[model samples]
Target: MSGDFDTIRDASSSDEVQLVRLLEEKIKSLQIEIENLRKELNYYKAEMEKMLSPPLIEAVVLDVLPDGRVLVRSSSGPNLVVNVASHIDQKLIKPGVSVALNQRGSTILEVLPQKEDPIVKTMEIVEKPNVTYSEIGGLEEQIKELREVVELPLKKPEIFREIGVEPPKGVLLYGPPGTGKTMLAKAVATESNAVFIHVVASEFAQKFVGEGARIVRELFEMAKRKAPSIIFIDEIDAIGAKRIDIGTSGEREIQRTLMQLLAELDGFNPLDNVKIIAATNRIDILDPALLRPGRFDRIIEVPLPDFRGRTEIFNIYLKKMKIEDNINLELLSQLSEGFSGADIKNVCVEAAYMAIRDGRNKVTMKDLVDAITKINVKRNNMESMKERREKYS
Candidate 1:
């Protein structure tokens, strides 16, 4: 009996110890869970506080008073006298500086750093174009001129400085549509290793008043910030057309945009390392102020490819295609008179399509001829329709 009682007591004592250890582990687990929940609760509280805060308004300091008061022009409301926060930097509270205002817009909260306008940010081209000079078959002289005017100034500025001449600020490429004007700009972007900003001139002609001019200003400011940059404005005639006093709001707005462009071109702010390239199909309609000596500096005309140029272009386009030995590129070039580089490329593409349709493995001379014939017929029909429309209108 005594031995059995002792065994039972020992078993009960061991079970009590195990139970105590299990309870302690449970308490530790609960404590850890409480800590995590507290952390989550704090995060939620912080988020709620942020959500409840009033939104601040952007304002510009028009003038600074000797006292703590400032003349601020709120972005949404009229000018008002506001008091600057005591902790805000007084130096940055000067005129023309941006600042955040309180919910009431009666107190300056903090000075804001100047930011690149959103319009300019959208116009920046982050990727370099894949076009190279070798891919451009025609316009050797124009390419050479471009190199001397653009590449030389950028790659070897010492030559220009040594010769005691200011490097050219911009280049103007005028040609018919699809004649490789934009491609040349792309080649420049590829070659110079510069920040290329491609913007269509029409984009600057906004419907709202003052927006167009603002965009132009911001664009130039951005180009300045990203120095050693290239600004390629395609279809420049849209904004650079000759100004007229017709009194229409649209015309007036375009004139304002043009004025801003002129100012940016030769304004008090020097272009320095920034270069401009503009393309247009209608050079005659462009404003003379934009084409004048210092603004464009070099105006190279990109004409249609001549016979030799056409032959070279054909060879370039044909390089990737399997062709018969009897294919006469020279004859095709002769037949494609007045065809632009783009037109030749189209002809080649159409020829390949023809071969595929005929279940042929290679583009033959017959396919090439057929493609040229079909394209010419289509062009003639379009021209006839245009003539009829013009005559009737």
Candidate 2:
């Protein structure tokens, strides 16, 4: 009977131990469920806050008031005196600084960094162009002069310093359309080992007041910051046109941009390591001020290639194509009289396409001749249409 009593107590203790273990597991599961619920609640609260808040708009801080307010120009509305957020650094709220506005445009919620104009930012060439000096066929003389003016100073500044003379500030490349002016500039960019910032002159003529001048200033600032750089302005005749007494707002604006450009060419902050290259097809109408010695220093004319030049260009293009031995480049060059380098390249490409279409592995002389004829007929038709349009207009 005593032994039976001891077994009963032992079983009771085992049952009690099992009950404690289950209770402990229930407490752990409840804690895990509570944590998951807390995360879900927080997520929904954040979403609700985001949906309830008004959107912020971009603004420019025109001035900072002594009373701790800011004079801001909101993107959509007129300028107004707005309150600044207490958490923002007061020193950052200065004139011309960008800022963010609250929904009502009456409060500055954030201090923003000055934004670079997207148009100006994209003008910078981050990657070096693939073109090299050897690849360009014609314009040997022009290339030589360009190298002396632009590349020599960057590569061997000591030469210019020892001579006690300032290096050339800018070079002007003028020629007819379809010439190799722009291509030559790209090759220079590749050889110079410097930053290339290319811009079209017409882009400087902005619609708003003083906007063009601002862009000109910013462009030079960027060039100066990126030392040992090259600024290539294509078709510069658009903004560098001869200044007249037209007295119109648009004309005045263009003149202002031109004046700004002139100042940058010979500015107070010396361009120690920067070079400027400009190209134009209409140099005849450019202002005399822009062509002066200090501004353009050297004026290189890229003329139509001669017969020998045409032959060299043809050889260069043919080397890249699967051309047959029967194709006489000299003869092709003779037939392509008055053709620019671009026109010659077009003919070569057209010939290659023709060969491919006819199920041929190599371009033939007959294919090249047909291509030339097609180009000539098309050119004549375009000229005729242009003449008719001019006459009727």
Model 2 agreement with the true structure over 1-393: per-residue lDDT tens digits: 999999999999999999999999999999999999999999999999999988898887655678888877787878889998889888777655778998888888898766677657767564466678887777899999989888888777888888877777888999988889888888887798777888887767753456788788777656655657788899899889896584998888888888999988976222367788999998999999998878986899998888988888989898999988888888998999988899889999999999999999999999899999988888789889989999999
- Model-by-model lDDT, in order? 0.82, 0.83
Instruction: Name the lDDT of candidate 1.
Output: 0.82
Please report, as a residue range, the 10-residue window in candidate 2 with the lowest summed lDDT. 266-275
Instruction: Give the CA lDDT, 0 to 100, for residue 28 in model 2.
Output: 99
- Extract clashing residue pairs from model 2: none
Model 1 / residue 70 / CA error / Å: 24
Candidate 2 TM-score over all chains jointly: 0.70
**Tens-digit lDDT string for candidate 1 (1-393):** 999999999999999999999999999999999999999999999999999999999987666677769987788979889998888877666555779999988888888888867666677474566788999987799888878788778777778778778766879999988789888887877787767789988877753456888888777766655556788999899988886664988888889888888887885222266789999998999888987767886899999999998999999999889988899999999898888898888899999999898899799988888888888887788789989999999
